[model samples]
Target: MIIGTAGHVDHGKTALVKALTGVDTDRLAEEKRRGITIDLGYAYAGDLGFIDVPGHERFVHTMLAGASGIDTALLVVALPEGIRPQTREHLQILSLLGIEHGVVALTKADLATDRVADVTVQMNELLSATPLAGAPMIPVAAPTGQGIEALRAALLASVPAARGSGGHPRLAVDRAFTLSGAGLIVTGTLVSGRIAVEDRLVLSPSGLELRVRGLHAQNQPADHAVAGQRVALNITGPRLSRDMVTRGDWVLHPAIHAPTDKIDARITLLPDFRLGPDSVRGPDSFRRMAPGAHALRQDAEVHLHLGAAHVMARVSLLDTDRLEPGGDALVRLTLRQRIGALARDRIVLRDTGATRTIGGGMLLDPFPPRRGRRTPPRLAQLAALEAADPIAALTGLLSVPPGWTDAAAFLRARNVGADEQLDFGSFVRAGGLFLLANTFDRVRDSIVAVLGAHHRAAQELPGLQAERLRMALPDRPPVAGFRGILDRLLDQGVIAQDGPWLRLPAHRISLSPQDERIWAAVMPLIAGERFRPPRVRDLAQALKLPEAAMRMTLKRLQRMGKVTEVAPDHFFLRETMAEMAAIAAATADADGLLTAAALRDRLDNGRKVAIQILEFFDRIGVTRRSGDVRRMKPDWPRLFGGGG
Candidate 1:
């Protein structure tokens, strides 16, 4: 377990850490010379790691980086000074980051022995309002070792058990530098998942892929590390350099490398925010009346600190134009630069001047839509994202308007593997997307209704073409998912495909009387040798008819969905075509690729005829060809009632 120290400057946070562990946290020459931590420092005592952060107001940003992934917080309050401004701010930041357990160390006890009781009361009052309420407060002086053993025991009791490997690894880089012979190395908390030596990772925002050459977990050399540990990785890549990677960048799995520029979140303003001149009047008037009361107004530019990244962003209010001090509301943050963010990632909001932290919140949707952001449906989706359980959140999202959810994107944003075995209950899967079962049924009925309207308007035509029919739907379903719905309808016999057209099962076209006689005479001749039927010229000569008339009749038959034209003037009966498709589906290899020679052997037909049939399947979207090999397409099952 990793423990992060939090409190005011010169409060003995570093000294206490050194008393517990032999290593001094302040490593920088400047830090040692100045006797104050300007950046984050690290120390370890066996399995417990300590992230020592600067306590000064100016270095709060640096403190947040170290505080992001700690299992427990060590609150270091000076006994003589009691609680100070930074002590409060750091505690609030810890609570915002969701640190629920901690131990309080009232340092400088030797000097303030008489004042320890009074300072303890002050600490108790402050702790009562935060997540660390019942935490034990021990007084210790690093110089004299007063209460040192008691403080150590309290800290050990507060450490939570080791965390599980939950998802893909994401390390927010807080420090990056080059070693003389070791190449480039980065150190940060392993936010999630596990990382092993030699694992390939991608540096986000710039998308440079790198390979991990070595690693140290919890200040010890290890071949692998899990989440909730401070890790140092030695990584190398062709385009990589010490300068390319910085404090704000992330090194993560390639699958989790998406960087987003917009975020929808619920932000709460710090009670200390000063009311601006344009602050709106309301129940928060009492707060405005305070000397420094302020409001966070819409379109206000601010500094957004997430992970280790700090970027400028413009806040767009969703539920209100102005947010009073100590008030919370839903809002959208449009960032000036992209950052590697994901759902539930904690964010710190600072004023544009970077003077003080105004507010902070958790990200709901990192990849939010630009339009209709204030709509009720979008708000409902945001509400659903508040659920702590991913499955429950997905259940809520699947029930929202249009009832279509991009399942892959939702899971990916939460660091949940899309291929993981999740029980979605009754939600229907359409390729990588999902829809409510009821919504899918409505889509099915809508498809039938559109076809019925088309059949009424154009009685002479067979039906509507598949693409045109899809375009007519109100939902405008995606191509891959729409094909799945169409296949289900066809399998259930609720819809029928006539050539390239889709229609209700009852729809049919009648041949003219004169054409009817010719079709009757031609049916049996082709049926006798359906696998290798004669061409239009041979059929015309057999019937002693004009070649043009035979071709015209065949083209008319094509429209009626009686036959498929495998090649120019060469046709096969619908039943025969379905049979050939089944043969191809059965003959393909495990990889779904089949060659003309394979199909020819299966059907005992000539190689030329098999090639012609395979080419036809390609044009109709059944198979995709690469050189001599053809692989079945996702919609290969759509044609002829789906043989593949």
Candidate 2:
């Protein structure tokens, strides 16, 4: 387990670690000269790793980088100083980061032995409403070996056993340096999974691949290290330099690839959070009022801290425009830079202008739905996601009305367990830039119902066009999203497609009994005319039928592929069009070029009808017209399934 020290500056946090482990964590010359910790320091006691952080106000960002991944905290309070400004801020930061187990040490006991009891009372009162309210307070003096052994025992007893989930390994680099003969060593707490020597790791945000040359756990050489241990990795690779890999970067498994610039989260304002001047009615009144008396207005700018990454962001409250202090609200954070983070990761928010921590929360969705983000349904979905487990949330989001989602985006936003990912692999289907699943029966059923209605309404048509079918659906997804669902349906044999049209797999175009009679009567007249068939008005005149009826019958025949409409007013049997195409190909010269005159003689038809047929060929890509000559396209033979 990793234990981090938190308290005011010069409060003996580093001194306490030195007394317990016999190693001075203050390795910097400036830190030694200034008599204060400026950066994060490290020491080890047997198997327990202690991260000693600077307690100065200016180094809070640096301190947060260390406290982000600790299992427990060692809050040190000086007996002489009691509770100071930084002491309260550090404790609040620890609570915000979700550090539950810790022990508060009243340092400098030798000098203020008489005041230890009084300091302990102040410490208890400070933690009364915080996560560490019931934690044990031990009075210890770093010098002269006073209460040191008891402090060590208390830390060991309070630290929980490390449980490895066997997920992908991720290490947030806190320090990077080049050691003699070692080259490019980075130290950080292993957040999850395990890493062994010679293992390949990828540095995120940079996307550079590196191999682990060596490993150290708690300052001792080791072949492998697991989660919850402070480790140093000796890394070597091409183009690798100490400057390239720095603090706040991540070394993670290659399989973990999702990085995001926006996230949906559930945020809680601290009780002492203060709104800016713009949010208040009067500046004087705001200055006189106590903290936690106001609410965070919409579109407030803040600094966001997740893992070791610090970024500027804007908050958009989803449930309400104003968020009261100590109240929880679902919000969206638009980040200024991309960060490697996943859902359920804890994030701390601070006011941008004041740099004081306002609140912290857990990431709900790293990639939220861009459309309808502020709708009531979307708000409800986010709430459900906040309440569900990772696996359940993933499945629920995939089962949305769209029935498809970007695989990379969905996987990146969810922190799925290794076991759950392995179990649910088959449930997710991949098609056309999306991860599809039939988990939502309603979406599937709706698609089938819509296709059935389309087929029933247009019985004479071959199938419903893709765009038309999309419009008919209740929940109209984007074109790509609709295609993904259609592809899945086609794969399942629930739907069939003919060129640009979609239909039920069992659907077929058959004329009704009444229309079949009309078709039978019109076939002879159309076939007799062949290349120069009668127009709709001429056909109705000859058959003594209504013009609308004649046109409807011809349209049905066209849908059945038994007739072809070469021009606006001309119609021909399918066999005649194929015959005309063969004649046109035969009449071409060695260059495979023909003219209307050549085809007119071959078909023995008028110039107008011949020109119409040639233009029809051009429209279907069967022939290309240049000046006065028509050239046979390469695929002309396949155009009508006939030989040249």
Candidate 3:
């Protein structure tokens, strides 16, 4: 369990830590000389690890970096000073970051022995509304060891249970340096997942692969580390140096290495600023703005802090143009550079000048679309993502417009493990895609509706072409996903396919009596030599029929779905086309590529006819061709009857 110290500066936070763990967290000479903490420092007590953060307002960003992954906060408030500005600000920050468990420490009790009771009452009032409302408050003075044992006992009792190691490993690097013998070392809190020696991970925002050579967990040498612990990793990578990594970067599994520049989130604007007892804002700073100036306007530039990294960002209000103080709304943040962020990661927003904390909230969607963000459907999506239950969130997303979600991305964003058990209830899964069962039914019905309309409008045509039918749908799903829907409909006998055309299974066309007579003679001639059907000129010569007449009759047969035009003047029977497709499918290599010569060898047909057959498949989306090879497409099984 990790415990982080939070309170105002010069409040004996560092001194109290020394009394508890006997390790001075302020290791830098500058910090020692200045009697302040400039960066994060760590100390350990048995199973408990404490992150001692700076209490000064200017180093709040650094403090936030250390506080992000702590399980319990050790709120430090000096007795005589009561609750200072940094104390209140840090409390608000801890609340925004979702810290639930904590213990309050009233430091400097020796100097203000008479005021301890009054300060304790004030602390209780402040804690009454936050997550740690009923937590215990202890007074301690490090100089005289007053109440030191009581505070230590309180901290030990506040440690949360060990979290399950069922997520991908993600260590938010707050410190990076190189040792003479170790090469490179990065240390931070293991927020989730697990890591072990020899495990390969990626350093995000840089895309460098790292191999963990050694590690320490909670100041103890260990072979493996789990979530909710302070972890230091000695790693090596190609072209890797300490400079390539920084405090804000992430060392995580490659599967979770997505760096995004734009995010959709739920934000709460902090109410009008109230100057604390000891005001720190400079004279020129806008500590006192006009009545409504604090309202955040649309496209307002601000500083965003996540983990230990801070960058400039522009806020685009989704629900309102001007968000009044203390108001809540959905928003979009466009960052100046990509950050390794994920869903539910807490973020803080500061003024453009980076002087004052404006507001903060939880991130919803890290890879939000660039446009249509303000639409009603998108707002619904944001609301769905806010749900704590994964199933509830997925249901909301799959029930909205364009009712489908990428299954892998959804699970990854939620940090759900592959082994986690979740009951999605009723849904349709096509590879990595997921959709509501009702949505799948609607899409299937839409496909039949589109084909029925096309068949009714054009009685002479066999059916609507596959690509045209796909474009006609309201929810234009990707080609691979659309094919899955078609396969389902075809299997249920709700729809039929002919070459690359789709139609209702009941739809059919009748041939004219005179045209039927021409088709009767042409059918046998083509069917006799199925694999290598004769061209129009050869058929016309054999029947002593007019060349134009033979061509017209075959063209009419083609429209009726009886034959397919393999070339300009050549055609094949419908059954013969299915047979050839099966042959090509069987002859193709593992990568799905087949040479024309290979097809010729399988069919025992001449090379010219083989090329023509393959070319015909290419035009109908059954296969794609390169210089001398053709690869069967995902829709190959749907070419004749429908299965793929």
TM-scores, all candidates, are 0.81, 0.76, 0.87
Model 1: CA > 4 A from native: 275-293, 418-421, 456-459, 515-644
Candidate 3, run of 10 with poorest lDDT: 273-282
- Per-residue lDDT tens digits for candidate 2, residues 1-644, read 79999999999999899998988999999998999999998988788888999988888888889999899899999998899988988988988888889999988898998998888888889999988998998889888888888988888889776756566788888899988988899999888778899999888767888999999987899999888888999998787788788677888887775667888899999888885443323322222223334778777777788888888777888888888888989998888888788777888887764347789989888778777778876876676677546556656655554445566555545534354444555455543333334443455688789878766787767676566777877776667556666666777888776543567778878888877887788789888878778888998898899988888778777776668888874678877776887778789999788999998888888888889889989987679999988998875654454322
User: Candidate 3 clashing pairs?
Assistant: none
TM-score of 1: 0.81
Model 3, residue 388: displacement in angstroms?
0.2
Tell me each candidate's RMSD, in Å, in order: 6.6, 8.7, 4.5
Clash pairs, candidate 2, are: none
Reference-based lDDT, each prediction: 0.85, 0.79, 0.85
What tens digits encode model 3's per-residue C-alpha lDDT throughout 421-481?
A: 7786577886457889888888887887888888889888889776789899988887767
Candidate 1, residues 595-642, lDDT tens digits: the string is 999999988879999999999988887789999999877655556654
TM-score rank, highest first?
3, 1, 2
Identify the superior model by TM-score, candidate 1 or candidate 3.
Answer: 3
Cα misplacement distance, residue 453 of candidate 3 (Å):
3.5
